[model samples]
Every structure is written in C-alpha cells, then in structure tokens.
Target: MANAYVLVINSGSSSLKFAVIDSQSGDAVLSGLGECFGMSNPTMNWKYAGTKYDVSITGGGDHHKLAIKRLVEIINEYGLAEQVTAVGHRIVHGGEKFTKTIRINEEILAEIIKLSDLAPLHNPAGAKGIEAAIEAFPTLPQFAVFDTAFHQTMPSKAFTCTISNELYKEHGIRRYGFHGTSHYFVSREAAKVIDKPIEESSFISVHLGNGASVCAIKDGQSVDTSMGFTPLAGLMMGTRCGDIDPGIIEFLMKKGWTQEQIFSELNKNSGFLGVSGLTSDARGILEAMEEGHKGATLAFQVFTYRVAKYIASYMVTLDSLDAIIFTGGIGENALPIRREILKYLKIFGYKENEAANADARFGARGIITEDGTPVAMVIPTNEEFVIAQQSAALL
Candidate 1:
C-alpha cells in the first residue's frame, strides 16, 4: 500500500492542478499546474525532484484532455506512473445531494451533471476533468471529494435562508458551505495539536485565502459556516465582496446597472481591491499601509474586522471553543493580520503568544496561543493530502 500512489486533480474552468501523493505519508511525489486551456499559449508549469520546469502544451482547446495528457507524460518520465493506482478530484459543490466523498462511476458522473445548477461554475469543470482523466488513465479508479460534503451536517437553522420554505424545497435554495476538505483536515489536526480527541473537540476553522470561509465544528461535524449558498456570501475576500445587502443589487439595478455589470463588480472588482484601489493581496495591502496609503489601511481594517467578527459569531454555534484552526495562504502566513484578529478575540481569554504567532508561518505548524484555555493555531492546510487520503481509503 505504501507504493500505491493517488493522483489528485483539482479541475477549474480553464485550468487543472494535479499532485501525486504517497498515500502512506501524504507526501507529494509530484505537483504541477496546467493553465490557459483553449488558448494559443496554453502551458503547464510543474515541479519535480526539486526543480521547476515550464513548457507549452501540445494542444490548446476548451477540453482538458491535452493538458492532462501532458501531465501523464511527466508522470511516466519520472518512472512513477505504474505505481499510480487511482485518481482523486476536488469537486467544489455537491449541494444537498452528496454528503461524502465517493468513487466516481458513470451514474455518479451523471448525478454530478444534474447538480451543476448549484455549482454552475465548478461542477462542469470537475466533470470535464473526470472525463479527461478517464481518457488518460483508462484503467485507474477515480474518486471525487466534494468541498461541501463535510458541511452536510449543518443544521437547518444554520443553512436555511430567510426566503420562503417553498423556494428552498422547490429550488433547493439554501446555504451549502465550501472548503470542507480543508476544514476537515485542519480541524482534526487542530485537536491533535492541542492534544484533545477530535470527537470531543469544538473548533472554528477559518480558511482564509482568495476565497475565505469559517466553519463551526462541534464534535467533528460542521454545525455552521460563514459562507452561505455560494462562496460569495462570507467575509471579505481577495476579489469578492463577500456579504452585502440584497438591497444593494436591487439598488444598483435601479441605478441602470445591468445584472452582469453588478455581479461582475461584486464578484470581481470589490473586496480589498475595490476598497484600496490597489491589488487584492495581503502583501500589497501591508506594503501600501506602511507607506501611509489610507486606502490600503482601510482595506486592512475591513478585512481583519470582518474575519474577527465572523470568528466571534461562530463561537455561539459551538458548545465551547477548543481552538480556532487557521489555514490557507493568508491564514497561515499573514502574521500581522492573524495577530490583529486575535486581538479582537481577546474577550474569549485566549492569550495570544505574540512570539509564537510570529514563529508559526511559511509551512510551520503549531499552536500560536500560549498554554491556556482557548487556543488559536496556524495549521497549513493540505487539501491535496486530504483528497489523496480519502481516495486511498476507498482502495
């Protein structure tokens, strides 16, 4: 089983990320990204044996077949292709239908097609990747891990919207939180970090990156999450507006804004970029703030405040806060932001070990809080490992 490798794939609208993991240790044997499909300059950038290489793909089209074909070549070149026993995919939305990871079959793929209405942007891409993987590795078993599966345990009160029950029952309109794989991996790891059994631990897992969400986990199940029906309805993000008044959309439409125009701005131009009139990145925000740019300063404030506020709000959902699991790019590395957010949670009596927080970064993992009651940690998320691990379980 140690030689059984799982090839994990995360398919997007125009790109796919692949990683080969040693299911035994969850260590990546190879990882790479294929991007710009259906374009003239389609390319694949990959890392292997501590070296990076960039090369143009053979074909350019909307289909991922050519891109994945190239990845197969890379795998074979390294002489590890034969050991690859299965494939895993990171599916963004599974809706109310799928509650856990499952091996993909023809029927399962068709059901994923039906649920495309819920994740119109992601599920189709995942399906395409699945189809491509089948074409590339005809004999390999395939597994799909849904980002919303772990949150399936959320109670109706947490997932239901204020809209009429008729709409929810008819249209399936309700909250289905995302980032379940990361939330699951980190929450359990967090329990171990603090030396508590996962089944007895309560946590608020904050996955902060370009797309951010907070999940309240009580005794190993998600009870509530900040992200609602879509990823757009949570804390401020790199490019998304997160939560906003429904009236704003109506107001903008009344002000001669097209639906496309309004949504594009909300989903693309807003967040840190909209507020700061600068790049939507933490490093950029920090740099400009140090340079006395008021816009960046304001953006920083809004980002930290909203995240802290959400963390505080999730406390009400859990029985008792065991530790706040911080993961993702910004969550793990953004020291100042993490520190400021911890300051906001001071009311909970979590002693922020300033020295420890600064030390735990750039793939470093540990409890950032001092030895005490309520703990906060910086556990770098490994969604791929979780994908590979879950896929291995099915074997």
Candidate 2:
C-alpha cells in the first residue's frame, strides 16, 4: 500500500475544503476547511479521523497559499503523510474542453487559467490550489475532477444559448452547467434506491443549496438542466437572482450604473435574501414563516415555484420520469420546503406520502411519492466520493 492516499481539494473564493482519503478504500482519513482568506486570523478548522481539529491562523494576505501550507503541515504533523499517492482537485468549470477526469500537466494548467474569466470566483482558486500542491508534492500525480464534466452529455440544444454565433465562438457563451458532479452522484444513488438499473431509470434531480439548479437524467445521462451558461441562471439561489429578465441588466446600464454594480446586484443582492429583506438562510426564512412573516412567505413561494416549474419542464426532456431525487443542503434537510414542493407536483402525479414525509427518519432517503407513482427520493450527495472513485480508477 505504498503511497495509497489521495488528497481531494475543493477551493472556493475565500475558503478551501480538503480531504485525504484512502484511494483504495475511498474512506476519508481527515477533512478540513480554511475560511476568511485574504483576511487576518482566518478560521482554519479540520476534523481528522473522527476528532475535531479547529484552530485559527493569524495573519494571511494570501490564504490560498496559507491554506495549502497549513494543509501540508497538518498532513505531516498527524503522521499521515506517508504513502500519499496523488491529489484530486475539484475544478468548478472545465468548459467544453474536458469531459472526464484528466491528469494535470503544464498544458492542462494553462487551459484551466484560460477558463478562469467565466468562473471568476472558483477557477482561479482551483488553479492556485493546483499550483501550491504541485510545489509541495512535485513528484506526485494530480488529477482534475471537473464539476461540468457530468453535464457534457447534455445535447447541444440543451446547452446552447439563443445568443449570437459570434459570441459563442469568441467567448464560449453557452450553457456550461455547474454542480454536475453532485447531480451525477445523487442520480446514481437514486437509481439504486429505486431498485432500477441506472441506464433504465429516468430522474429529475433538484439540487437546492445556496446555489441551486435542477437536472434531468434520462437513461443515466444528463439530457437537460435548469442552469444556463452559469450557476446563476437557474432556480432562486441564496443571494443570486436566478432567471431574471436580461432587460433588467440593460435597464440598469442605461441608468449610468457601472457594469460591476449590475453584476453585483444580480449575483449578490437578489434571491430570497433580496426578496424577503431577510437572511438568505432557508432555516431563517422558515422560522419567519412560522411567525407569519409575509416577506419570508413570499421568498419560500418564489423558491418552490421556480423549482416546481422547472421540474415540470424537465419532465418533457425525460419523456417520462421514473423518479425524482433531492440533493444538496435545502433539498435534503428542509422538511417544510420539501412538502411545499411536493404540493405543487400534483400535476406530475406526485402524491406525497404524508407518513413518510413527516417521518424525520426519512431525512436522508425516503419514498416521498405514493405507492405505484413515480419514485421520489432523497439521496445525500457525495461529490468527493465520486472524485475519489474516479481517481482510484485512474490508478
């Protein structure tokens, strides 16, 4: 078992979430997250093999660099650095360039940088993590597991935007869907739970998190999805104004607002947070709903309405759906939100099983759909496992 570990790094704009797992077994030996990058005394927290390892690191102008340094240090300090085989990085957007797990080389690294503008918040961080890992583990192999890889099965019609051909060729202006890794893993899990072979099942996956999107899986492949050219194009996200009129952006520009301001409003100042004038947190909104808060109610309605509409729209893509699966934060945990979504799904012939719906044990996986109706289930997503599995296969 020489060099049997594989390190998985998922980097965000200001945070790096990492895990070290046994490549042979896919069991995470340690996991950690570093937050508040570029700020002083950022939170560097971790859990190593069942023990909590939380600590703050003071002074960091470049937390990405610091995060990698700390991560290497922790690996060495815990006596778990031995037999480290390779690094598997979660790259957010691989564009149309990569459709599978790829070994990283200078050429691949350059290509990743080329696509950074489209995923400004994520790609750069991914590149930074890759660079730092290469510096530290120069002799080790590294693989990139792309978020957009699974959605590559989407036909041109589903991913192609109604934009100009010149823009498409010049700027890659097409619907490069995100969160594909999550949808991919959860859909397979759903297929298993429904006792159907993946290739024989058709499912609509609703991934509801801070960033939300729905995907339609037909014959175990992604046929269509809600997200467009970016993650901001689908259902109402925590802050992002998903599916807003493009005219609003043009209207703002006419008012003499800078491009930066308009982007900020659509990406940051909208969604449940914007509509409710309350916290973007679903938990907080649900709490307000209990207190008879109208704004919160409206926010919840908007969220569910978009989800239901897309779920129905996606049904057309699937021809006929065998099951509907829920994954991501809100999709897995929010009971009331789940109930509301099912209420609108009656048109799809989804008759919610009240007993199972209210059963807290059904939190992770449940048959929300009534007997003989299309299966509806909850499958906890495991994107890291998918990466690990893919990395192991490469070995």
lDDT of 1: 0.91
Estimate the lDDT of model 2: 0.86
| Per-residue lDDT over 1-395 for candidate 2, one digit per residue giving the tens place of the 0 to 100 score | 36478889998888889998876666788888998877666888899867898888655367777778888899899887776678899999999999999999999999998999889888998999899889878988899999899899999999888989899999999988888889999888888887889999889999998999999999999888888888889899999999988998889899999999998988898998999999889899999999999999999999998899999888889667878888888888888888888889887678878777666233457777689776777887878878877876786
Off by over 4 Å in 2: 1-3, 23-26, 59-61, 360-363
Model 2: which ten-residue window has the lowest total lDDT? 357-366
Q: What digit string (tens of lDDT, one per residue) describes model 1 on residues 220-254?
A: 89999988888899999999999999999999999
Determine the C-alpha RMSD for candidate 2 after optimal superposition of all C-alphas: 1.8
Clashing pairs in 2: 3-83
Clashes of 1: 1
Provide the RMSD of all predictions against the true structure, rounded to 1 decimal.
1.2, 1.8
